[model samples]
Target: MDEIKILFLSHTVDYSKAPYDTGNQFIQALRNNNAAYLSYVQLYNKYGHYGAHHYLKKYVRDNGINCLIYGSSPSEFYFDINYLEKLRKEVFLVMMTGDTEYYYEIRDQYYAQAMDLVTVNDFISTFKLRQIGINSIPYYAYYDSTKYSKNGNLAKDIDVSFIGTLHGGAGRWHNIMHLSANGINIETFGSDSPNGRITFEKKIEIINRSKINLDFSGVSGKTRLTRKHQIYKRMKQIKGKVFEYTMCGSFALCEYAPGLEYFFEVGKEIDIFHDKEELLEKIKYYLAHEEEREKIAQKGYERALKDYAVERAVPKLISIIDGLRKTKTYKPSEIYLDEEFIRNYTTYRTLLIIRFITQLKFKFAFEELKIILKYRKLDLYQIVIFFKEEILDMFPRIKSVLKSIFRRQ
Candidate 1:
């Protein structure tokens, strides 16, 4: 097949502008292999939606881009009816989301409606999307082996270490405290930790130097989002830390989560823990049996390079894109807000209400809001914004409620 031109839209959170971003990694792999004509536009921490849509359209036309790879949800991008209508006819939109726990509820509904295909990092997330009639693919995180390989010179002196968020109520601190009390010494790193803001290079170093890299999904259970949904099912998705530590030649003792079985043999290539007691047991067993830990780490590294590296994964992604193009259909730029679509996807509908309220011209906004409100389904934030915008024109009851709120304030 001829080279497929791709425009990657990355939702970057880190302000450091690291070169090892997931989008950059995919781009480099494609470029390195002479696989495709690839370009990227980062959405977050940089451009507003209008600016994003402008550049996205320009790049699609100028480059004759065949595919657009969204690193997260399309909601993160500044996509409107005009851009959606124009680009859907030209480029196949593909979404690659790792954090299904957060995105699936709020952002993914937009992805479900907008994208040609959606690829998630876990099987559970993939299955859920497919059940909703989405063309979803199950994919795992890929790291560059050349950048993340183990250094023999770095001493594996640290027995246990974790290098991500310690807060946001995902129960990392609680688990860490439990393990610590049970006699496992884990060196913590990240912005929330005392070690603080390590570079990507530093992350690789730490991973290589640790005997057992303790990995957490960094999802807090106490959050309102989780409480409102099936929290356990969300946590069933695997984290990128599994691939990262494994590629760095460190034995990963990850918390029990689904999706690991698809990549690795749980007991042979990696280990998992359920609670403090189980974690402590595994840590003690692994530490005492140095040979076992070394074997698992070695197996993980081999698996990573052979099967999970970006070099290996990108070709497959390109192949999928190529296949998707062969079967591509010319879809009109219609904003999908069908009743069944709205009823099935609360987050998508809620986002539509907000986007309609906040993004459209004023003349269009009121009419759109009234239609959405008549639908009788909205999130708390959307409702607040609705009242604040006076979309209801303060019906007698709503006016009294607003008056009471103001009196309290």
Candidate 2:
């Protein structure tokens, strides 16, 4: 077979600029295997949607770009479905769902028809998409082994550390505060934390320096504190930090999430906790037993290097992509076009608009409105729901009564 040329498209220039490093690791892994002539474009940053569409079409034509991997959601770029469909004929289009829990219904499913394959970050999401007849696969987030290897030279000064955001409704702040109250000194570093966010270099250093690295696998819903948001905050999924912690040779005590055991042997390779009490108890035990903690950390590091490295996973991804090209059996689902489905999805979208407006993100709310109008005309029911939510914000007691009435039905 001929070499597969790839074009990696993302919203940011590179990994350093990106909020997450998953895309960069994938790009690096492709290069490591000498797969093909790979080119990268930060479409949104370089050009606006219209300009990006024009440039992308011309660039793909001028250059022999056979595969295009989009790292961001279709909604963020706002690419026309027709434009994507036309491009699909020429290239193997793959879309990556970074936050599948929230955006899969609102954003991803709408574009799955245009994609040759959709790569979900978690296992449950992959299964969900396949059930709906979309060609999907679990592309577990991997770490750059070259950059995140075990560093024995660093001193383990910190007791426990968490290197992610604590904002939104994930309940991370509550957990951290609980641990602190119980005398577990956690050096927190992320948005909304006392220390604030750290640099990429600092993150690696902190992970290695900390005796026990902490991970919260739960998903954060909308910033607004709603019943739905509260439910979402309790939902768990495999986190990218799981690989990062192990790759850095740090003993991780991650929050228990389903499907985590498939990747690592719990209690042997890495540890997990179900609640704040367990997390606190485990932290104390591990801190006291140095040798046991070191053994688990070493095992996790070996496992991560062998199985979860980006270099190791990219070949499998390439094979899957190649096989997909040969078979071409994937059929787009018409479920997104169903009237009842559209109505439900629109209701979800309106709730998101309310979320944005309440959070003072007027621009995002306006963009969501545009997306809503593009597909289906706004109806009286949607308008009523929007106002009802707004009024509910004013009268909490009345809102609670209505919430219970709806739940019982």
Candidate 3:
């Protein structure tokens, strides 16, 4: 069969790493799938996407783009509707990221209006979208472990080393406390996860050198303590880290969650933890049982090569999209909504507005009021992601305030 010409639109070209990113996954997948001309579309240099949404028309029209796979971002929602109408048969689908409410503004309005189906990277999130009356397909970004297989060798230099982020949240603190208290001599080999604090090569080095490489998925805050929806993606979404760890022949110690079984036969390929007591106990037992650990790692390595290749998975992704296009024609529903509600009330923007108004009204109590109000209703992870992106800008300004900011990036 002739390869499909598909243009993928993403907010990012890459997430800068193997475990949590889609870029490496897609590039390798296309190669494995023998996908002809699997071009990825990103809008960093070609002007802001809102503007490119207009210009992309000319580009899409000129190029024989058989199918359009749109990715997430508030600005990258709209396509060249005018040109798409002209080549009405060409643009096949729109894949929107529905993980956060950042896209929710135009989700029901413009996004669902532009494409055939919704694609959620998280299976649990996809089910949530379906539960809330929106139809979506669950798509997981996979890995081509050929590279890892080539470099998979355990040289006993480090006993236990972690290459993920080690700052933020109670879990992060817990990790720090445990590592410190245990005196396991475990090096915080990589920077931090939240801040994306490690290099890809460094990751391989850490896994290769360390006998016991940690794979804690972190806690997905529950409904009583936190909203289930937000926690679901954090814990349930099978990260490439899980597979990457397995592929590198590192003995993984992970938390039990959805989609894990898809990769490994828990306790065989990877060891899982249920609680702190179980985790510490398992780590001790596995460290002692060198032969058993090696056997499990070898098993995981075989399984990763056999089951979790880019070629095997990418076709599955395309097939899901193809199936969606087949079952339901890509007729986007035109929607109308109040512009006021969709207003971009960014965290910085809101603070700026508040600061300007407060300075004019009162100066003495404004600082106190601002401090009290800022913590009242902001999603913590949003703050973290935002800080990670704009840390340089915010660093200088808030250096005095965030004295103990433990950023690993």
TM-score of each: 0.73, 0.73, 0.65
Question: Candidate 1, 352: how far from true, in Å?
Answer: 15
Better of 1 and 3 by lDDT: 1
> How high is the CA lDDT of each candidate model?
0.69, 0.74, 0.54
> Candidate 3's error at 295, in angstroms?
2.9
What does the lDDT come to for candidate 1? 0.69
**Candidate 1 residue lDDT tens string, 1-409:** 4567776665443436777876567656766755343223233113333544666677678877778776643333234433554667778877777567555764575556667788887677778887776688887746788887889898889999988878844668888888788888789998789898899888899999999998765455533233445554345447788899888888999887777788888988899987777888999999999998999999988888787889888887778777987787866533555443353334333444454445444443444455456566545653464445455453677877877799799
**In candidate 3, how many Å is residue 179 off?**
5.1
Return the top candidate by TM-score.
Answer: 2
lDDT digits (tens) for residues 166-275 of candidate 2: 75436688888998888887899987688998987789899999999988877766532122344565677677788999998899899888778878999899999998
Model 1 clash pairs? 49-78, 169-220, 170-219, 170-220
- TM-score winner between 2 and 3, please give it: 2
Q: What is candidate 1's TM-score against the reference?
A: 0.73
Best by lDDT: 2
